[model samples]
Target: MSGTFQDRIPVLLVEIMRKFPEERSESEVLLVHNMLSSVSMFRRYSGTLQLLLARVVRYQRLERRRVVIKKGHWGHSFYFVFSGLLAVTKDNDGSSAFVDKEPILIKKGMSFGDVALIKTLRRNATVVCMEETELMVVDKEDFFANKMDVELKREFDYRFSFFRSLQLVSSWSYSLIEQMADHSKAEQFRYGHVVVKDTNDMGNIIFIGKGQCDVLRVVDLTSCSAYQRLLKQYADSVSRGTCLPTHGFKSELTNQPGSVIKHKVLLNNPPRPPRGLLADLPTSACFLIDTLHQSSTFGLNQYLMPSKQRDCRRFTLVSQSMEIMRVEKTRFDKLVDNTTMKKLEALQKTYPSDDELCTVFLEHSRWKDYKHSVVQDLFPHRVAPIRSPKTQKQQGHCGPSQVLQQTRHVVNRLKQTKQRVEPKDNKIKK
Candidate 1:
C-alpha cells in the first residue's frame, strides 16, 4: 500500500506542487511526509490521502500568533501544520484571564472547529497559531477535484477506520467493530466533583481517551450516617475491574485496562425528571474522573454541556478531530468473531462507523441483528449483561438451566420491588 501510494502520490503531488507558492513548498513537503509516514494507522487509505494532500492549496502563511480559525465562523477546508505546533485555543469565559489576554490552550488532539466543517455547523472553539506555523489549506473544491475513482475512495475511507482501531488493539475484528462507533463525549470535572452516582442505565460504553476518575458509591450528601455506611460497605471491594452491583449504576476504575466504568452520557441525556425535586441524596454524583493533566483537565466538561444548541456539534467536532487522526477502525472490526459480532448485532450497538456498518452486514448474515454483548464488551471489563428474553435465543450456545436461572434473576427482582412498594401503599392508607 505504501509503495503504491508513494508511486501514485508523486503524480498527484505534481499538480499541487506546481501551483503552490514557492515560499511554502518546504512546508508542504513536510505535511506530505507526515501523511505518508502514518503507515500503521492509515496503510489502506494512504493512496487516497496522498491524493487528498496533493489537491490542497497552500494559501496564506499566517504569523506564529495569528488567529487562523475563529470560533463560530463557517470554515470549509482542512488545514495542516507543516512545521511547528499550532495551539488549539479558545477565549476564557469573560474571566480575568481573558482581560489579561491569555487564551486557554485546548489539548493537542482536540482540533478546533473541524467538526463544524464536517457537520456543516459553526465552529465551537477558536484555533489560534501558538508558534510560527506553516499551513496547507484544502477546500471542498480540492476534496472533490480528483475524480480518479469514487468507489475505491469510499472503500478506502471505511477500511481506513477499520485499520485504525485494529492497530489500537489487535484483539477486535471488524465484525466485532462494525457499527461500533457510537456517539461519545469528552467531559471534565473538578477533583472532588461527581460525574455520576453509581447507577447503571445499561446503555452506552465509556472510554477515558484522556484523564482519569475515581468510582464512588451512591451516598447521601446531606446525611453523614448513610454516607459513611455506604462508603464503608464497599470501601475496598469496588476495585477498578470490579463490576458495580447488578442493580446499581455501573462504573469501573480506569487505571486498569479492562474495568467496568460509567461516564455521564453527554451525547444524549435523559430528559430531566419533571417532579421539580432532586432524587434521594443528590444521587451521590460519582467523581468518576480521577486524573487530569493540566493539558486535558479543563474545557472537556464545559464542551460536553448541552448548551451547544446544535447538540450533535460536539460529536461532529470530536469526530472530525478523530478524522484528522486518520486511523482506520480495522482492529476493532476484525475482533468481531462469532461472539463479538453476535453481541454487536443483538444490541444494535452503533459506533462511529459512518457508512462502514453497511459493509459489515454483507460480511456476515448474523450481522443483521444487534447484540447486547457488543455494548457490554465496549465497556472495558463490564460483566455479563442482563439480556432481554427476546434476545435470549440469540445469546448463542447458552445452557438452558443457566438461562432460566438468569431469567428468574431479572424477573424476580422486579417482582420483589413491587412487593416492597405494596407495604408503603398500605402504610399511606392507614
Candidate 2:
C-alpha cells in the first residue's frame, strides 16, 4: 500500500488490483467501499456502513452448489455477492423437492437476503453458489443494530397496524403482516388524485390507511342511460310535490297533484322486490361510482387471478388526501401465505351479489346526498353543522388547554382498547 487509494473500485476486478503487490493489502477496504456504493440503503448511512463493514462483515468462501441460505428458516445474515455467480430459487409448495422453481441468477456486486433481514422474517428464497464464490456477510445482530435496519423496523411496525385494520388481511398473524409491511411503502395523495389510470397499468395493490377514495368503474351506456331516466323521473316527482320512494327506490311513485294546474304525470316505473332492484345502486346509476374508505383494499383480485383470465380493475381509485400503503404485485405474490390467500378467497365469497351490492350503494349514496339534504331542510335551525376536530385545529383553535382535554379523552379510549389487546413490545424482532 505505497500510496493508499481511498477511492472505491469494482468488486469483480479486486483480484486485478491484487496483482499490484504494493496495493494488495488495501483490497479489503476497496471491497467494503464497493459494497457500500452498490446498495442504495447503505448509501443513505455512510458512517454506519463504514463502521459495520470494518467491525462486522466477514469474507466467506463457498464451493460450487453450496447452499448459502434456505427458504423458511429464520434469516440470520445479509450477504453481498462479492464475487462469482449464485443461483436464487424459491420453494413453490414448501416441500423437499430437489428441483428448483423459477431459478434466478445473481452475479457479482449484487445483494440478497436483505429483505428477510429487514423484516426479521423467514427467508422466502434460497441462494446457492453456482461456482466457488466469495461473500461478505453481516449476521443478524450486526445487521439489525445498524441505523438503517432500526428505521425500517419502525416503519414496518407502524404499517403492520394498517394491515390489521384491513378485512382481507386482518386475521393474518403478526409474522405474516410484518412481511407484508416489509414489501409495502407509504404514499400520500392530494384530493381527487387518480391513483390508478388504466386498469392494465396499475401494478400494485393499494390499501387505504387514512382518508377516502372514489372507486369509479367504467359503466356501459345502457347503465348510464337508465340512471339518467331514473333521475328524470325523480326530478319530475319532486316538481310535482310527490316524494321519491325510499327503501332504495323500490316502491312505486304515488300520484299527487299540485294546485289546479291539471298536469298529468305518467308513472311507468314498476315496483320490484329489493333483490330485483340492482339498477338502483350508484354503480349502475352513473358512469362513475364513488366508494371505498379507510381499511379498504384494491388491485389484489387482478393479481391473484391468471393474466389470461384476470379481471382487470373494473374501478379506478381516486384519492382525497389519502395516506395509503402499496405493495408491488411481484412482492405480494412471493410473500402472501396460504392463510392470507384463503382469507382473501373467503372475502371474495362474502361479496354481495351484483344486485344487492348495487342496492347497498344506492342506499348509502342516497343517505349522503338526498336524504341528508331533505333532513337539513326540515330542521334548518336545529341541524347545527357538526365541526370536525381537524377543522377546528386548523383555525388556530387547538391551544395547549384544548390539546390537554383531547389527550385525556384519547387516553380514556386507549385504556378500554388496551384491556382487549396488549401493546406490542418496542424491541425489533430478529
Per-candidate Cα lDDT values, in order, are 0.35, 0.52
lDDT of 2 by residue, 154-221 (tens): 66677887787667766668877777876665666677556765556766777878886655433322
Error of 2 at 225 (Å): 11
Best candidate according to lDDT: 2
lDDT of 1 by residue, 142-184 (tens): 4555442353345545544543443223446444333343112
Alpha-carbon shift of residue 40 in model 1 (angstroms): 9.9
Off by over 4 Å in 2: 1-113, 119-146, 217-286, 300-315, 328-430
Pairs clashing in candidate 2? none
**Superposed model 1: Cα runs more than 4 Å off:** 1-45, 57-60, 92-114, 147-430
